[model samples]
Target: MFTVLPAAGGYTMSENTKVIARIRRLMALGTRNSNPHEAARAVALAQRLMQRHGLTPDMLSLHDIQESVCQNLTSNAEKVPAWLSSLATVVCMATGCRCWFGWHIHTSCSGVKSVRRSLHFYGFSGRAEVALYIYTVLQRQLRADTDGQIAGYRKRRILKNTLRRRADQFREGWVSGVWQVLQSFAPSECENSMLQRWLAQRHTGDTLGNVNVRAAGKCRGDRAARVAGWLAGRDTEVHQGLTGAQAQQQITAGGCTHE
Candidate 1:
C-alpha cells in the first residue's frame, strides 16, 4: 500500500540505511517469534553493524526501536520481508525516527537468544485466536477442494502416481488443518478446568484464556508462605511419620512467610 510522507528536498537515503530499516521491519512482522531481550539483542547487533561501517548508531530505547520497526522500513533491493518492506521505506524516509541514519556497518551476534514468551512476542494469543477462527472456516472448505482432485485422478487411470499424490495431499491437508486449528484455539479453550482457572488470571475476556497472572503469582507465593509457617510449627516437633527435611519442604512449598 502506498503512503504519503512529508516531502523531502532532494533527500535520498543510502543503501545501508535502507537495509537496516528492512531488517527492523522484518523482525517486527515476526512478532510472535521474539521477546524484548531478543529485540535488545537485535538492537545491539544493528548498532554494532552501523559502528563497524564507520557510522554512528543511535542509542535507541526499546520503545523507539519498536516504533521504528513497526513502521516497515524497506529498500528497492528488499533484503527482508519484500511484502512489508515498502512500508519501512516510507516510514524511514518520510517520518524519520531521528536515528543517526548513516553508512557504517557494525557486526556481532552477542545479543540474540531465545526467551520463551517474552513481551516482544506480542499478540500470540490474539493472533492464535484469529488463526483458529480462520482455520475452522478453512477446514470446512478443504475436503471439497482435494476430494474433487482425487476423484478426477482416479478416473483418468493416473493410477499409481495419482494414488501417492492423493496420499500426500491428504496428509498435507490434515497437518495443515491441525496446525490452523491449534493456532486458532486459545489456551482458555483448554480441556482442564484447573489450568483454565490458572490461565484465566492472565488472559481474560470473552476469550477462554483470560486470567490475571499477577494474581496467580501472588496465590503461588502466598501458598508457599502458609506452608512455611506450618513447617515452622513442625520444626520444634517432628510428626509421627515425616522427617525434618520433608517437613521443611512441605512447609516451604505451602508458601509460609519467613518473617
Candidate 2:
C-alpha cells in the first residue's frame, strides 16, 4: 500500500516524495532478499510512478525536506572539451537539470601549471545525482567506441585526415543516438516547463546553440562503427533506484572518474 499526498508548489512534489520513498523501500527489500524478480518488479513500479506523477530528476529533489534545490560539482583531471559539454547539456536537458563548465586550476607534482575541468550540475539534489551518473556512463561508452573505431581505421592504413573525419562522423552519430534516447525519456510537458523556469532563474545568460549536421560528414565515416556506437548510446541499463554515494561510485568507477 502507498499514501498519496496533495500537490505542492503547483506540482505534485509531496505525492512524488511518497512514491519515490515506496520505490526505494521496494528496492531495498529486493536487494536484501537477493531476488532478481523482486528487483524487476520494483523497477517496473518506479517507471509507473515516474510516468503517473510526471516525475523528472528535479521532482526527485523535492524528496529532501531540508532543501528545495541543490547543486553538485564533478571535477575531472582533464580540461573540458566541446564534446563533453555537448553531452552534459544533453544529459541535463533529459534529466531536468542545468549544467555549465568550470575550471579548477592547481599546481601539478612538478610545480607545473594544471587545470582540472569541472561540470556543474544544478537542480533538485536527486535529479542532479542521476544526471551525473548518466553523464558518466555515456561518456565512458562514447570514448570506448570512438577509440575502438579509430584503431580499426588505423589498422587498415587509413589516412590521418580520413580517420579524423571518421572520428567526427562517429561522434555525430553517437550524439544523435543519445539525443534520440533522451527524448524518449523526456519529462512531461508540465514538468518540462517547471524545469525550464527553474533553469531560467539560475542561469539567465545561458542559451542553447543551434547544431548543423553535415550530410557529407555522415557519409564519410565507417557505417558499421557509427551504427555500433549509436546502438550503444541507446542502451539504458541503469539502476533507477540507486542513490547517494553508492550510486555515484558504482557508475563513476570506470565511467567518468577522471574524464
Predicted structure with the largest lDDT when compared to the true one = 2
lDDT of 1 by residue, 8-51 (tens): 23232232556556445644544434577777666666556556
**TM value for model 2:** 0.48
Off by over 4 Å in 1: 1-125, 166-259
Model 2 Cα lDDT, one tens digit per residue, 120-181? 56444355667776777676667777887788778786777778667766765676677755
- How much RMSD separates candidate 2 from the native structure? 14.5
lDDT of 2: 0.53
Number of colliding residue pairs in each model? 36, 0
| Model 2: lowest-lDDT 10 consecutive positions | 1-10
Residue 184 error for model 2, in Å? 5.5
* Candidate 1: 10-residue stretch with minimal lDDT: 116-125
